[model samples]
Target: MTGRNSGATRRTPAENAQLALLLEVAGTPKPGNVDRRRDLEDLRFEHFLAGTVGAGKGLRRAEHGARVGIAFERAVAGMSRQSGGNTQFGCLLLLVPLVSAAARGDLTPDGLDRVVADTTVEDAVSFYRAFEHVDVAVRDPPAEMDDLDVRRGEAAAPTLRERGLTLSDVLALSTGDAAGGGMEEEARGETDGEPGAETEAGTRGIPDWNAVDWTTGFERPFAVAASIRDDTGPIGDRTARAFLEVLADRPDTLVATSHGPAVARDVSERAADVRGDLEAADALADALVEEGINPGTTADTVAAGLFVALERGLSV
Candidate 1:
């Protein structure tokens, strides 16, 4: 189940991660998100295919101690040029480190954490560069830090530099609690001395991006991976179920960003009701698309989960 090698006559871990991304997008009736049968005006199935393949290859070839931010920037830049649009930005953020960890012959929680802790300030710079290359929509930052707005893109680089924030620092700042407050409150012990401190106690003693559920430890991905691993059925069914479970468990941050907290909460509740009911889930998926409510962050997490599942040799 290790990610180091796929054995003779098998695809590499990078290839498996790519396949997982493609299959996740291809899974039909996946609620509000895009699938093989559904496509957004600016985002299409082909765009995802190109992005996944390009980013997966870039991640596969990345060297140890390489700045994940730089790797992410290169992957997204290539994808943007090829697809002429933004697709899989979040997927790349989650997968690049996993790819790097697998390359190092370890995909365990501890292994991945070590990789994340090693990211540098240059990595944070590269992250902001990637943001500039895309047209991602996110919620506004705190009122006090207008310069930190992601919408500002590379324009925020100087501020990031002045503050000496690393990639993990940026992620920690963006990480939000269920109540949508800053991470400061919930990140007490997990982070360093300051609430929501960038670093953790162990490992490299550097910033702890794993402080948030979405960033490190691959928490959500691991949960969904375990679900997919336990399933013994068609890959499509397993993927759909895993997506439902994730959607039901948490309100999608992307949804909250685009719409609002209310819409995100409603979608989560709907997912909970439809979970475990294939027919109901299908109907709900159609209704969500009609309503223009996409649980995109959930879909991104699902892609990462599929990657983990594949890396671990889950049958499918």
Candidate 2:
């Protein structure tokens, strides 16, 4: 039941989730993301490993109505204590609900939506608390809504409390303008603190939190899952291709925040350009890193997708 031989043995959903997170960071040639051979000055492979291990218990507790936000806070806190940095903030955000749903033994798309929809206001507060514990960079809130700024961290908690905004409500606001303004643009001018925008509650909406795969019934993650499900190669190849699929499909929000929308779109186009050739994709990865463009959100989606693949018993 140990080592590679353990693949044939059954693993709990939590174990599968943790392994998926590890596989994600370990996936090489990920293009601008930290991998086994690549490390940021402030983040490293060991840090992500630590974060995944640190978050294990919290992920196991996902069922029984454990608030995802609280689980996320505890997971990030543990990771910070171990690594002194925010190595897996986005991954944790995406994994918690998925892990929770998996724990319920019904991680179907509908089940995931239910788990997300069930999040409460306290969950939203705890999610904000997680931000205070890490130095994760996110886009600004709409210009008019100072209170909704994620950078405000715990300072915005009082208003969140006052407005009784549940985690879903907060996610809805963050999901940005339904007309395709993108999360980065929704808070651009603000509207005197009014709600940002809304979706049909069933249709696809732009994701505000890059790692929040559960927001839209795990749409992006499921898409990645679909791509890799048929692969029988090493887990790394599956992961790498899934990353490309996510990048090619959309501009990464983290890249957009760090660079700009134009740069993000350019990166997406480059990924699309290289999608058919592994060597070209590797070249693109090197170029992206050279230019300091990290498609981190896309990486998070890959991790979530890998989790789904594993949970569904897709051969790694």
Candidate 3:
């Protein structure tokens, strides 16, 4: 049921509904500690659910498309913080829907946004590519990126803020205005420490720490889902879905993948293969591959491999 191998075939109604849920959840903002790993798992599940229920039997294609956009936007928003507002994350976000649409032969990412929000194709591409490693998503800027790249990301930060294009905005764009706006408000309140936001957290009614904690060790979920979504080679839909399910069912796999890069980074500084010190670079690519996080038709498998090497301090 994975879109990668389905040749962009229509999704089942349940899959569409689940996609809606994933978009909603991912777009909603949370603290810095929010678990992306779990967020991705939910998304994968939604995809699976949609297929299980049958398309047209439940959710319409348009409804599914809208929700898909929302899910992507949310992932971008949630991950943008770590992406350091770089094109890597932004590009990843922007590219998902376009890629998905193109793959399905139904929509182009740029065309949909242009029609829905009056955005230009160039702007949409720029916004998505903004996730480049030097952007805002990084917890700490990488040493390898040129100062100009770093500045570029910083400069773009204001546009994202002004446009209210948090990670959720990426998802909302697909879901529609109402869903996107509501999620943005939630993210804003959470970031600002608003009353309902604070009180609702850890309480029964709203999304809170409990929600975060319930989806513990999200790294594997993200890695696996990203890998499946981003996969573009010979893999089949069933294999891709199985990959994600494995990650969701066993959270440790995500952590394990994360660990490989993390450990590699720590041990490789100043080594002959200096390129390997770029853990974030490698980690991001690997996670993207593992989770199929790209928005374009082509998967950056080469980049993912490079990043894996970088994470491990290995010479490619």
Candidate 4:
């Protein structure tokens, strides 16, 4: 029951989603992320491409009305087929629901909101299953919920079922925004914070801000999509710029996790300084690469954003 959005492009929603993955990696000068010319010690550009190719199966499943959790897990499984490991885990987290919403004939924020909210405990179980296939760089879960640690993978399933937590519930709990406005703070992520400290880690394990995107009405990616749509010049350049915008808006949780929050905030400040200066941006790109500071979460959001922009008719 897959459906396409009525628009100028003839490609299926699945094709557009895959193209977004390609476009995000192809964009040059994306500081701290694997791109046309950059590769982390563990991840290469080709790995991303291969991951994209494998991701199609999962994307198609989502388009055809697969449960959000099931589609995301399958997509993660397919994406893990490559040597790059978990190249697009966060991207798929955002894209699976977006593609499902589009196929269901409502691609707006409200529509996406409902899709995640409607997830079942089975979906949570499937999401945990995704972790078993790939080595995503996730922190350990909170202590009280050690039984639900994603690292426990399939072993966490029975606990999830007993708790009656849906995939959305799991994500919201992971972000610790279920009971506060921290979810909203993560949605914008550009506000002031300590330059030498990690942002107050509301919760430890699971993915961070992108998981927040799951619970925050998917605001950040859509906003980044708007930035992409309003920009000019080559699509690669547009993507590069949008990547920076996301970095500027928030200290990337991935960078924060591996490098510490202070470094992540410093990176965000650097991104803000890039503003209209591509030369400065390129310089920062070089520095980030040299320092091994990978703002992968920002890249994932940008990929999801690119998908949103393309689906809404941003052209090639």
Candidate 5:
């Protein structure tokens, strides 16, 4: 543990040395040097505590909710990066401290609430921007030129290489379901006697009654939901709401399908499954990248999928 700084007016010599040490450790190239990362995290944790106390005084003088919320959100993001390893598991560790601090009124709960409410399409982009170095991107699997019916499981999995994303390009994919519209309601006849206008008692019902298209309406959001689920597992209700709110500016609008209700239910369930798959992939990538694995073709596929999903929806 580093020495504590008790003096209000000046930094101790030990504190100055610790700050320098943190910077140097973060710049190292060794793979999974968690000890070095941990040092930097510890410093940030100290800053989080200090900021919580300091922000309370500032909040009293602030009036704009938006401004306050942005500051609060940034503070929380910083606190999250600190406190330990920056993996998803490490993030959970900070939740308890965050809740306790917020409960004491040291950190403004309203500020966080406002931030959560403000998850607009713009916010989604902003979220990516804030964490650019973390390698978060949209996921979209590509269409197999050789095999059109290929699923992700059959495709070779790839992990991140360098500091950039190359596979599962979410931006280029279409999100509509694979099925065409259901139902065959007749057009109102101009001629009353045109082709059996008056049907017998045993008339044929809708031919495609059971034909539900996977590539139809609600695809984009569902795909987005799927990717998020894959990457992070099924988030809580509040988290899901926050995510949807952030994507409010997405251009795709869904028309209710024949099985719209059923689709909605399935989409939610599928999102969770996707999330689990994604987290496992991320963890695998982290380990492989640490071990100097050559992603090669796998990297390209992941990047392609990510681009396709984000831009075109899940149709790819």
Candidate 6:
């Protein structure tokens, strides 16, 4: 709690984005996720710290206006430099755009909307390339989407360009009900300069709810940030609380992929049960780790929320 900041000088957007990553992992009792007080057998607290440090270059890149996909790819590659296989892939996914918006001196939904609206085919290419650098835990894309499967990584670049897909276009394709797009619909700058105008794609692939952030003005992180700011206590407590709140609100995609969707639902129910009590959360944290259940995406959202909260000047 005492170490949330350095000197009194105001930090840059990139600096706050990086610190958000650290503060997220530093928070304790975030059930089923790695935190300062707990660790899984393979991934550890130190690994997250290392991943954050490694991701510094790309965070700066986003601040300097690198394309969203390119900056995200750079961040993932840098984050993989440590022994941890993919410690912060999702966190970086959520941070890049926020950092970019903050750099423009507008850390609001409107600012993020403008940045994502400018995504290009090249940005989509680098985004696919980013998946190659880490073993991200993603479910296989639906059989029909074989050509666009992220697992294809850079190999799908040609296809992406052929379809004129932007990074926003791809993410829009991942949202719930995936209710958007024609064969060549320009998702970039659509819907009054926002991404993901629902079209033909059905909610087919069991949408990566975590990715909804990219399409809907990053609504979840923004909501969680407000939750954190409105609460009282150490930053760690606020983060932990926000994590639980997010988990309770929805089934985590990673959890659904690892376990079953039913298990993911049960986990969310468990989170709902313990969210208001840090002591109960600590107890639940121990049980969840022992059970090998990790709500990874919710943790990522919490990190994203921390970034937004920091950008909004939530006191440490």
Highest TM-score: which candidate? 4
Candidate lDDT values, in order: 0.67, 0.69, 0.28, 0.77, 0.24, 0.76
Report the number of the highest-lDDT candidate: 4
Which is the better candidate, 2 or 5, if ranked by lDDT? 2
lDDT of 3 by residue, 185-255 (tens): 11101112222222222111221111121122222223434444454432233222322233223221112
Candidate 5 local lDDT, 1-316, one digit each (tens):
1122234533322222222222222221211122222222123234323323333322222212333223323433442343331221111111222222232333223422332333343322322232322211111122332221112211212211221221111111122211111111111001111112322111122111111111122223234334533543222221222222222212101101211222223333333333324343334324423432211111111221222222222111
- Tens digits of per-residue lDDT, candidate 2, 1-316, equal 1111135666776788788889998887788887887776556788788878887777776644477888877777776666436667777777788878777766777878887888887887887777777666555444677776766767778888998987777777666533112332111111112222322231133354443455678787877877788865778877887788788888776666655566667788888987746678888877877776777778878888888887766654
- Scored against the true structure, residue 278 in model 3 reaches a CA lDDT of 29
lDDT of 4 by residue, 205-289 (tens): 2237877788777898889988998999999999998988888988787766555666777889999999557778888888987
Worst 10-residue lDDT window, candidate 4: 180-189
Model 2: runs farther than 4 Å from truth? 1-8, 63-65, 177-212
Tens digits of per-residue lDDT, candidate 1, 112-228, equal 777778887788778777776666655444577777766676777888789888877777666642111221111000111121121121112211122354355787788888898
TM-score for each model: 0.84, 0.85, 0.25, 0.89, 0.20, 0.88
Angstrom error at residue 299, model 4: 0.8
Q: Which ten residues in a row have the lowest lDDT in candidate 3?
A: 180-189
- Candidate 1 local distance difference test against the native: 0.67
List of clashing residue pairs for candidate 6: 177-203, 179-198, 179-199, 180-198, 180-199
**Candidate 6 segments whose C-alpha is farther than 4 A from its true place:** 1-7, 177-206
Off by over 4 Å in 4: 1-8, 177-207
